[model samples]
Target: MTESAFRCLACGDGHSVAVHKAVADYFLPTGIRVDYVRCAACGMVQQYPVPTDVGPFYAAYPVHARKSLLQEVTRRILLSPVYYDVASLRRDQLLLDYGCGDGWFLDRAKRRVSAAYGYEPTAMQASRVAERVGVQVFHDVAALRAPLAGRVDVITMHFVLEHLTDLSGTFALLADLLKPGGTLHAVIPNLDNVEYRGFGSRWHGFDAPRHICFPNADQLKPVLDPLGLRLASDRFVPFPNTLAASLSILFTGRYRLLPFLAFLPLAIVWARLYPRGTRALTFVKHEN
Candidate 1:
């Protein structure tokens, strides 16, 4: 109804480019209609008119959880480097998982890191995370005071940072939670991927309201660097099932097994063709 406005979450650069105005209903999982835009200055993609109620946006999370064999294999494929990138595996190493929904990754990270904890904004999912993974989940950072302060060795945010409405506050909180050389690991959708170029507004990754910010390598660098964090390494790790799902979405607008007919070769071809474009990334927080 009204023209939306936005200031760049990274550089404070404002924009008014109407790249595409579409509703992402089914895929968002957040169940909120969203308006998408692209920045003219830095080419970053983001959602406009931030949602007022963050509740329904994350309400369907725990209720509609999925951890199939395909998801497990994909996690292994993309998470290997994340483990190797940390390079400090030992017992009693306290780790915090920001926005850990259902604690699937936390379940695995616990095996490597001595101590694992997580915080989930969604109340329903946060409860399940603790019940399922045996880790405590706070409603927000402010809830975590003396106990978690300055004790976490590694802080992780998998597919989490993009949803933040406050980067400065979020990062500052994460920074405070970490020990002196502690690292903050995050994985998010790659805005520079060729799949987005080929699919345009139909790109499956842009799940609208849920994915508020679709940042690329360049967009993320300046944002994190100011927080004493750096992009230690970034790589493309393709998930065959997700790629197949994308192909299904592009063709028929719903996931189907028929397109998975050439699942093997298609996966390899897509991975090779657009390696860096895959929604794969591993970043570490650096200490000054």
Candidate 2:
């Protein structure tokens, strides 16, 4: 391990423990092993040697995978901003979906908000999503920031915070993009999940280099406070894909539909009982 990866990006802790080594690239089998390190001070988990050329790693990403009508309907309902009420959005409001991914949410959001913009870092995918969803999708962060800074009423980042390398910078940039009293809804993987203790390296939340960090609300308090981003509220929410993936790893190394279906009810019940899984954290910008 080197100095860069050894130090915790979340809390600037210099010491960490290598929790999981030789972690496979589960999404695409890119043949690159990612080592997991946990900060002793913050208890935040992150990938060692954080991925730089993650493009190759995301080549076979499943966000674009075709789904059955039932799957699509359920996904739309469960993952939609409408599901979480996205800061109690209204038809007069403007919203931004950072790393919006295929614009499914944006499609749903159009009926509820005055304007919906998306920022997908992948240019090709952004084009396709823009064409498919008929929304202003910006591939460049500078382009996204230039026009919308301090103007957007609401922003949503779904399982996106974990994929970035720069923690403080990303938060600051997102905070800067918000209108005064605007809200940011972030869906993050909960590191405190009981499954994390049972699965360790096999936990789907720690998706190797693809997911740079896990839920670190405690560690991030210092980072968000100065930015005027207040933690309005947060709650445990189960992402079916996350549960299915974890259940798959529990059964085999990959997805198994029958077993996944069989155990899903139990998993949902367990998630409710323990109440630590995917977290929907809402942060509101101060009105000053």
Candidate 3:
């Protein structure tokens, strides 16, 4: 890989300091080490040379297929708050779940909302999910935007924003897709979480190469401000899966759920008290 000048994706500032190095992917045996840096301008952490060829990496992504009962339970627990928020505000309205892997969330959401659609970039997975869930699955943004632009009542990108490389452009597109007073909800790993400080490079939040940007509220506000998407609420939302991921890296160098089960009690307490490993933010498109 060729060395290029470090540029902050969040703030557009060119100055930063190496914060973490030699971070390995816990999912794959790629033997790749990633370096993460913190931008001085906005305190955002990001990976450099942002993995352009990510298709091969996600070929074996576990979530692309069916999940076990335990996995489903934990996923619901982690996303309960988001579901509640969406349900309260988007009752009987149109909803879209971007990056809807396997359409699990979209499937559940369809029961609550008047209409639910999903967009997944992976063609095979999208087709499989659309068939399984009986909900429309779009393969690209254009397909999603063509029908729903400026009409979607609720749009979600749960645990999806960090995986995107073009943060600014994506937010701009989301702003366009949302109707006035519509909500855009997102869940992302918090770079400032206690687990990140404790685990450092081994932090599950830094799922190297896959999670390209580590954004905080400061990093996100500037991008959404000009687009008329005001930050309505920001809260720390912890997921026990992160602890499981961290322990997997420490012990087996891969993802496993045994540690997660053992840590469930402590994870619950920590989630209530700290709630920092992940964050949920709601951005509302202002009515003009």
Candidate 4:
């Protein structure tokens, strides 16, 4: 509702509007109230005064938690197609799954591709992935670059970009890692979602402190084009859980399923809309 000197993390725009102000009611990692803003120029939504150390917020984060055998099997059957199609993965191509958590996707992807690698933020996760999946996982940028620079054919980010602080720097590193004609595939939550309108700060998409930014697709075009990545395909990815989770926060204080049989149809309708609750975008690196 108000404008200030907030510097947008994605586009460097000065003009912005205060969007939401809320405590971490759902996550409760920190009770401190955080303010969110959307850049008027770029339409990127982000938190103000980005936390100095986000470690505490993720202290109990289930980002890489092991899933049950049934959960793992369900994920393989349902989620693998999204990445494979977006990346156009082939048996001859090498893949690097940036922010690969638990290596579940990479575990299967390695079986299909010529080679597969992973990048995680912690040594514990990197080690778990290496042992469990037998796929090489790296936490050091320098070490990753030494081997992968201009060699990887595809890189994937699954609900990972929003948690990162450095958008520009991350894309630059992606450009360095991918070969010409390579692909950068991602799945991101859409702020344009009708759920955000209905739930406001309580919406799961806001996810407050952990999810730092929600950059519009248009703003990403200029950010990626100069790095030799072109937006090749963009479409909404159905996120049935968004509405249910938001409703849970509205009724219950934490994340748990509530029978909202009435809203199921609305979630289905919103998923098909242009400005959906979630989206998948595929960008192809230009061949020089």
Better model by lDDT: candidate 2 vs candidate 3: 3
C-alpha RMSD of each candidate structure in angstroms: 3.3, 2.3, 2.1, 3.2
Per-residue C-alpha lDDT of model 1 across residues 1-288, encoded as one tens digit per residue: 454357766656776588777666545444456787777778777777656566667655432386779867855764554333444656768888888766777787777777778888767677877888887878767877568877888787877877887666787788778777777766776667667777665555665666778777677666777777666656765544446556776777744557644454686576666555444444555666
TM-score-superior candidate, 1 or 3: 3
How well is each residue in 58-106 modelled by candidate 2, as lDDT tens digits?
8767775546798787676556532446446798888998888877777
User: Estimated TM-score per prediction?
Assistant: 0.83, 0.91, 0.91, 0.88
Residue-pair clashes per candidate: 1, 0, 0, 0
Compared with the true structure, what per-residue lDDT tens digits does model 4 show for residues 1-288?
Answer: 245557777778888777886647475546556778788888888887666677666766665788889767746654654454634568888999898988877876787788899998888888888889998999886789889999999898988888888788889999989999888888888888667887888888777778888876687876787898898988877665567667777877655534433454565455445347777888999963
Candidate 3 local lDDT, 128-188, one digit each (tens): 9999999999888777767888988899898899888788888888888899999898889
Q: What is candidate 4's CA lDDT for residue 123?
A: 86
Which regions in candidate 4 have their CA more than 4 angstroms from the true location? 1-5, 28-32, 77-82, 86-88, 257-275
Candidate 3's displacement at residue 243, Å, is: 1.8
Q: Kindly state the number of residue pairs that clash in model 2.
A: 0
The reply for model 2, stretches above 4 Å from the true place, is 80-83
- Best lDDT goes to which candidate? 3
Would you list the clashing residue pairs of candidate 4?
Answer: none
lDDT of 2: 0.78
- Angstrom error at residue 241, model 3: 1.6
CA displacement after TM-score superposition, residue 25 of candidate 3 (Å): 0.6
